[model samples]
Target: MKKITALIGSAQKKATYEAVREFERNLKSHTEIELEYVFLADYQIEFCRGCKLCFNQGEKFCPLHDDRDLIIDKLIHSDGVIFATPNYAFHVSASMKNLLDRTAFFLHRPYFFGKAFTSIVTQGIYGGNSIIKYLKNMGENLGYSTSKGCVLKTLEPVTKDVQKKNSLKIKKAAARFNKVLMRQTAPSPSFFRLMMFRMSRSSMKEMLNDEYYDYQYYRKNGWFESDYYYEVSLNPIKKMMGRIFDYIGHRMAGMN
Candidate 1:
């Protein structure tokens, strides 16, 4: 029997979680794949410190040592991985991005390389494709099989009717994903295909060296700094700034 791990991440405790849970439940009904879900909400993981300690220094695995290492250990052993996250500001949520950033520790590790992986991006209205593209690149560049991944977009106000339809769509997608999961081994690539793979790898290496993720960690005293790390940086400075500006504007309008 195949084993699967579903990495569920959410920042807002929103409706999308229900959808992901339903998708997992649906998958359980069909395949013999043993599924394990690691919900970020339940765990305490520190943000990546950007020190590259996991890669270069080789000191204690990750720069920010916390539950992330333990969570990753479980994911490493699973035959397949499923990343489920919500879309925020036209991309994946901060919690999900932090998790991805921490994966730099395993960049050279064989655990994730060439492993089957999929993704689910739940959003209120738009940006599912953008988030999905981000995850697809992560899979391809990190050596995970990209063929099994998928993206799902949900309606803004999730009602019963929307939930029913969305659940059915997710079930169908999961079924399709299970087919790929069953066949763990990849078929041999022809000479031309092999050449293409080589070329793709070279290109991906170049792009990854630039590393575009902007991850922020917070101190225990609610201060923002690179070295200060927390499991989840809830209400980041950017979000807080937006709220502050909104509050000022609302007060001025009231005075007017």
Candidate 2:
């Protein structure tokens, strides 16, 4: 049985929570999964102080001590993760944003490779689509193979028609997520992701030293010489592109 964790940003059991519940049900129809819902509001999380300790040194050196690591532990143990939030003022709720802020170190040293990730955004009228896009990007930055997320326009006084529509959207999203979750091997990196890894690693090799955490992490992972994050056969064209990206990165590092 696969363990799936859904991080719900809302405090109340409302639209976003219900949407995730429906998603869980739909997912279970496809395969056996143990779904866990994590309500961020129930945990004690300190707002980030922008000290950059986690980025420069390590996450263990952060000043604030809270439940951040506990949440991260759940993610680490899960096969898939779902980021569900209600659109508050055209963005994710405070709880969701705070959680992401706390885990900002993942942007520098991503750790969720080979995991499945998707987003569920609930809104009254507009802006949920953009939030879905943002969360999808966030998942990719965290090294998850992300499925395109879904947004449900959940207005007040929920009618049967709206419920039906939301159910259909949730079902489709769940199916897509399940397929990615069941995959036995990691997917090949896209051209853009390949470029990002090559360029970033090349720049780190040229500009940064062992004093920086990123440089040390890259060196420890052997990213300085690897073609990509994992072993994969790249075509001749992509191999050439990778070299060009490396050259561009080296030039950029020199300019800085």
| Candidate of highest TM-score | 2
Model 1 off-target regions past 4 Å? Answer: 12-14, 59-61, 108-110, 147-156, 159-161, 187-256
lDDT of 1 by residue, 21-61 (tens): 77677777777768787778777767776776565534364
lDDT string, candidate 2, 44-147, tens digits:
99999999989889999999999999999999999999999999999999999999999999988888998999999998989999999999989998999899
lDDT of 1 at 251: 51
Q: Name the weakest run of 10 consecutive residues (lDDT summed) in model 2.
A: 226-235
How does each model score on lDDT? 0.60, 0.92
lDDT of 2: 0.92
lDDT of 1: 0.60
TM-score of 1: 0.66
**Model 2 lDDT at residue 223:** 81
